[model samples]
Each structure stands twice: as C-alpha cells, then as structure tokens.
Target chain A: MKVRVEVMLKDGVLDPQGEAVRHALGTMGFAGVESVRQGKLIEMDVAEGTTDAEVKAMCERLLANTVIESYRIEM
Target chain B: MKVRVEVMLKDGVLDPQGEAVRHALGTMGFAGVESVRQGKLIEMDVAEGTTDAEVKAMCERLLANTVIESYRIEM
Candidate 1:
C-alpha cells in the first residue's frame, strides 16, 4: 500500500528558507508572492493492511516535528 | 483565499535527509519505518478571487522544484 505523509511548519514559526525564496521571487519579479514556508513529504509502500490510524500514529509519534510543524496523511 | 502547496521529491530521487531520519528512527527503536523523504510546503493568503488555475500556475512557475518534485494545491 502506498502512503504519503506531509509535514509543514506550523503557523507563527519562523522560516528563514521560505523567506529567502520569497525574497528571491520578488527579486525575479514574481508579483503577489507574499510569503513562503518549507516542509517535508515522505512516501513509502507500507505493508498491506496498514491502517490509516496506524499511519497517523506513525506521523504523530515520529515522522513530524509537532513543535514547529503539523502533518497530513494520504493512504 | 488561503492556499497550500505541497512539494515532494519525485520517485527514485535519492533523499539523504530522509535516509538520515530513517536511520535515527531505527536507532531510537521505531519499527516499521521503512523509508523517508523530505520536501516542502508553502501556504499563502492570496487576495480573494485568486483562481485555482492561478495558484497552480504559481506552483509550476516558481514555488516548486518541478524537476525533482511535484506539487498539489488546496484552496
């Protein structure tokens, strides 16, 4: 079974990388690019029968940085 | 309008950061964590009337690394 996990910086967290990209975009004349934030995505082929709850638990338990990020899963 | 963009490494791309995390998880006794890949997410509060097509254009034109990653948008 294929699964996708997305981890993104929580609101109110500082993202220097994102800011850099935003500035670069502005420099390159990209209008309306107000901000940017970077995060992570993980895709894996888990064993068959892996439950969504279990995958979510994996995210909450290890895959994400909860202090600075939140996660979503697609199964 | 609020939008989310998710950028993830394309399949078969080597992900050193993910490998590192997987190793760490193993060391910390996390079972069943077969693999990991790192990516990025960007969220923006665009002006009202921003269309999904425009948001997608932003992603393809700048926000994502299209060569090694793909993006999805949420409005």
Candidate 2:
C-alpha cells in the first residue's frame, strides 16, 4: 500500500521560510504572486495491509508539530 | 476565495531535507519509522472571487517546478 501525508502550519502561524521564498520569487519578476505558505509532503510505500488508523498514528506521533501544524493522510 | 497549493517532486525524485528530518527523528527515539519525501504547502487568502483556472495558471507559471514537480490546488 502507499500513503501520502501532508503536514502544514495552522492558520495564523508565521511562516518565515515561505515568506523568504515569496520574496525570492517576487524579485524574479513574477506578478500577482499572492501569498505562499510552506509545509511538507511525506510519501511511503507500505505493506499492502497498511491501515489509515496506523498511518494517522504515525502522523500524530512523529510526522507533525501538533502545536503549529495539522496533518492529513491518504492511502 | 482562498486557495492552498501543494508542490512535490515526482516519485523517484530525491529529498535530502526529508531524509535529514527523518534522521533527526530517528535520533529522537521515534520508532516504526518509514521513508519520507518532502514537498511544499502553499496557502493563500485570495479575494472572494478567485478562480481555479487562475490558480492553476499560477502553479504553471511560478509555484512549481514543472520539470521535477507536480501541483494540486484546493479552494
């Protein structure tokens, strides 16, 4: 089985790294760039018997900073 | 209408940052750890009338490295 997990900052959280990327892009002549926030994508090929519950556990325990981020998993 | 876009390397693409993050987690005594691939989460709060076509265009023009990545947009 395969699972994809995404972890991102909660709304209102400050994202300095995303801001830096936005600044860099603006300097490159891109327009209407809007806003950018950055997070992480984690993909793994698991045994065919993988369960969503187990994967969610992986997220709560190790994949994200719950104080500042929320995570979702798809299998 | 706000939008969130995620950009990720195609499968088989290397993710040094994710590997580094994984290594750090391992040292922290996290177990049942698996592989991790890193990508980006980009979020924005647009005007009430933002269009998906425009967002897709933005992804094509600037948000993602089409050569090595793919993107998805959510409203």
**Whole-model lDDT per candidate:** 0.77, 0.76
Q: How accurate is candidate 1 locally (lDDT)?
A: 0.77
Residue B25 CA error for candidate 2 (Å)? 7.6
Top candidate, metric DockQ: 1
Across B1-75, the per-residue lDDT of candidate 2 in tens digits comes to: 467888888878888877876676567654444766778878765556667876777688778999989998888
Q: What RMSD does each model have against the real structure?
A: 3.0, 3.6
Residue B29 of model 2 has an lDDT of 59
Cα-based TM-score, every candidate: 0.72, 0.69
Q: List the residue pairs that clash in candidate 2.
A: B1-B47, B1-B48
Chain A structural similarity (TM-score) per candidate?
0.88, 0.94
Here, model 2's chain A TM-score works out at 0.94
> Top TM-score: which candidate number?
1
The worst-scoring run of ten residues by lDDT in candidate 2 chain A lies at A24-33
lDDT of 1 at B49: 78
